[model samples]
Target: MIENRNEFLSKIAKQLGRPQPTSRPERNFSFSPQHQVLANATQEELVDALVEQCKNIHTKAITTTTADLVATLKQVVTDYKATSVITSTDQRFADFGVLPLITEHWPQQEVATHQWQERCGQDNITFAERADVGIMVSEMTLAESGTAVLFSDKDKGRSISFLPQNSIILIPKSTIVPRMTQAATTISAMIERGEQVASCVNFITGPSNSADIEMILVVGVHGPIKMAYIIIEDQ
Candidate 1:
């Protein structure tokens, strides 16, 4: 019985002409589009144009000094009557000065952990929900688009970002990449260096939400109602 079955399968294979598979061709599947329009732009002109375009995205941006970032954050919390702020444990944020503010509310809390999700969600969801603003340090910035790139890692958990009602990102001007091509190049370099990119790499343009309901506009449906970016001078 086994021999007959094997013979039958061999005959079918011989009749079917089973061919060996070959490797796929290397094609350019990159995000960069080789268009003439982008090729003609100077770095300064590109950054300026990108910044202007981003401003019109309905998001707020402020040119900030390191000093201003701390002061503004303090002021916003005070104005909103917010005593607590949820932030990542990333070393960069140490200099941004978010710890003291957070400590005021959760006195014993020195670091933000994922476990806060449940408590934060149950407590009106506004504390850190659509009203809870999370301030984070970005991995890089696209100068041509004035966009911030966020990568999820141990220090900066993914939940801290999406869970908040508003997200305030702090990026330095010097880390800005000129174009999408340059951004992709940086990504490729990271991959080559054996560094595993975060599970989620969010490219935040502005606040979330869609106006497709009746063609009217609405914000903060799926994400934060507001997104504020602090572009600090590259020093």
Candidate 2:
């Protein structure tokens, strides 16, 4: 029994001499400029390519002045089957005449208003989930990359962009910049100027896609099936 105990203690002491487990250093992941699809396209070419892609998906691409965008959105909303619930964070959307057409979901609690985040999820499962499409307004868009950057503000939350089956973005042409670096610089400048940094800055290019499952390409797995960007220019 003494010999057995001694052997057990010796084994335990030997095992303790092994190397301690260590954690990996956190990596700074980044997008490579060399592989960025829209890094160098001219404005005309970028817009044309985007419009072509939009047409392939049966989406309407309309160019309007900032003044007319609101009126145009009203017309679009009027023609489409009006949803029981519509949600957005942009007050500029109010200028478009879409605010009255769809129920406004706010982030804050009013006398009767439910929280926007909760309403957004519920709307997704109930309205957006059942319906074919939903719409979101972008903070800014990068014309060079054909990317829509959505950030959380007073009215908009990130959940609205991520939880829906389909997402249509209304990007004002004025916000269209030539490059991502310029966009980042602008945002950082804004941050320095005391603008509250948003909880998330989602730079979306087209729709969510994956080629992970058996190396088969699939769209809309993580997000929308159809993603459309209407670059509303003040032409």
Instruction: Tell me each candidate's RMSD, in Å, in order.
Output: 9.7, 10.8
Angstrom error of the Cα, residue 165, model 1: value is: 1.7
Compared with the true structure, all predictions reach lDDT values of 0.64, 0.61
What are the TM-scores, per candidate, against the unseen true structure?
Answer: 0.67, 0.61
Compared with the true structure, what per-residue lDDT tens digits does model 2 show for residues 1-235? 3568656766776799944334555776785663465656666666676566555443456666666665665555445433422355567667665554444422121211122444455553454344434567777776545677888655565555666655668877666665577678889999999988887788987777788889987877887666656677643
Over 45-110, each residue of candidate 1 has an lDDT whose tens digit, in order, gives: 555665676776666766667767667766554544443566766766556664555555334433
TM-score between model 2 and native: 0.61
Q: Model 2: C-alpha RMSD to truth?
A: 10.8
Candidate with maximal lDDT: 1
Cα misplacement distance, residue 213 of candidate 1 (Å):
2.6
Displacement of residue 100 (Cα, Å) in model 1 is 3.9
